[model samples]
Target: MSQLFSPLTLRGIQFNNRIVVSPMCQYASVDGFASDWHLVHLGSRAVGGAGLIIAEAAAISPEGRITPHDLGLWSDEHIPGLKRITNFLKANGSVPGIQLAHAGRKASHNRPWEGGKAIFPNEAEGWQTVAPSALSFAEGGPVPTALDDEGLHKIRYDFREAAERALEAGFRVVEIHAAHGYLLHQFLSPISNQRTDQYGGSFENRVRFLREIIDDVRAIWPTDFPLFVRISATDWTEGGWTPNDSVALSALLKEQGVDLIDCSSGGNVPHATIPVGPGYQVPFAEQIKREAGIPTGAVGLITSAEQAEEIIASGQADLVLLARESLRDPYFPLHAAHTLGDDRPWPVQYERAKPRG
Candidate 1:
């Protein structure tokens, strides 16, 4: 059997294959509630035969949102809507997962369709953004308030509560969004985090906040359920978060019971010159897995069944996460099974459409 189609067991959960639906924001929600769009968007991927479908970054609090439309878990009311989607995903034979996120200084932005610009606090649909330091993501961007001690405590509490809600909503896998220049990434990158306190300076200090959050979430999250952390393995700039940092952090997260490291890179700075290409980020996943001795998920520009299969077969990463490619082909996994000559089963209703030899 192809490694790509082989089942992966993490904690007490077993994935039917190595293909995962990477979390991509739809920017289609109202008051942080999952709408029918989320149900169809996620459910279709489940139906596509992905072993795992991680829903887009769900804000831990209202202020943590990248946009007003970002899905949220800050309230009990959001549970039912998400639970509905989880049910569909489970029924469709995919493991439902969620990425809990706080966008930090990146918050209060207009959606991509609206030019993806920052919306200042005084503007409609905007609220004050917070971060490890009082800095703007880009020059002339809105300066976020540096999180105070009270703010830190509250944010930690929010993550814990959000994890609890994720369980209540029937999600079996929970990934902490520490990547792509979000709140936790803000603390991890010295370019973004310049604090003089215990939360900054040294590597240990920079990682403390994320460690605390892992502790907070794991305290409530079931032991049998897999917990993943998505991280920017490199900032792609000098003196910024590097692959070494990711390896070390992955080791620590492994010790903390994190089941996987979803390796992604960049997004911590505006001036970064990432060498983007097919499988450009796969090396990072390979390095981290080898050095940190933890399962890693390779993501970014991975669009082909052969490429994904090679990743798993070569031991570069334990899983392959698809983003834009999955968008273009919701049935990518099903089609990939055919491309790889693996007789992966199709949904009963769609079996007639399945190509035969």
Candidate 2:
């Protein structure tokens, strides 16, 4: 078998292959609970042949949601549904993972297809949103209330409780979503973080929230299970968070028990012109892996088998994470095994589709 299909044992969790299902929010949850929609949405991918299947950004608290519809792991009641999905994924040979996130100023918004506007706090279902600074994503976006020391502490507790719930839900991997201009990212960027407090200003100060989260999560997270952090390597805007910042942060995360850096870019700002191209973000993963000495997952438009293989073979990244391509072809990994001429077995039920060897 090639490197991509080789067994990867990190800490104690072992992956059958390197294909990880990148977290893509379904925006389909109801009252922060995963429904039947998520079961089939995620479980089908596991059956389709991904080695690691991570659920979408699950809000740590209700107000932390990107939309009213986001899945959450905040309460004990949310565990049963998630446990069902995780059990299914594990039974099918996929390592179950969850992306823990707080959307910050991006919270209380409608879904992208539903105009994507902020829901006013005075409105029926809307409430106050919080961030490191009182900033909004755009003109129509809500002006989020800045977090006080007490509020920050509350969020930390919220995350801690959610981590406990994730453990109860049978998840093996926990990835803290600190990227995409979310609450954690809001604290990390000078463009958004206008606070004079310790949670803002210098790099160490800006990254303090994420650091505290890693500390809190590591306190509860099983050492045998892997912990990952997804970071936007650059904000793709002038004077925003840069790749150097990511390298420094990755180094700190490694010290904080983070096993991998999922390198994805260009979500802190919507206007910044990203030099978009196929596999454009792979270099970010490459840079972080080499500079920070941490295993990184490369994502963004990595659509083909050869593209994914060359990424691993040439060492651009330790793992290739696919979102859109995986959605387009859920069976890509099985087909890739055939196209790449690897002897990896297909699902027994689908053995007839296997290429003659």
Each candidate structure's TM-score, on Cα atoms with residue i matched to residue i, is 0.99, 0.98
Q: What is the per-residue lDDT of model 2 for residues 44-106, given as tens digits with 9 covering 90 to 100?
A: 889888999989999999999989999998889999999999999999989999999999988
Per-residue error (Å), model 2, residue 251: 0.6
What lDDT tens digits, residue by residue, belong to model 1 across residues 283-350?
Answer: 99999999999999999999999999999999999999999999999999999999999998899999
The window of 10 residues in a row where model 2 has the poorest summed lDDT is: 133-142
Give candidate 2's error at residue 202 in angstroms.
0.7
lDDT of 2: 0.91
Which regions in candidate 2 have their CA more than 4 angstroms from the true location? none
Q: After superposition, how far is residue 142 of candidate 2 from its true place, in Å?
A: 1.5
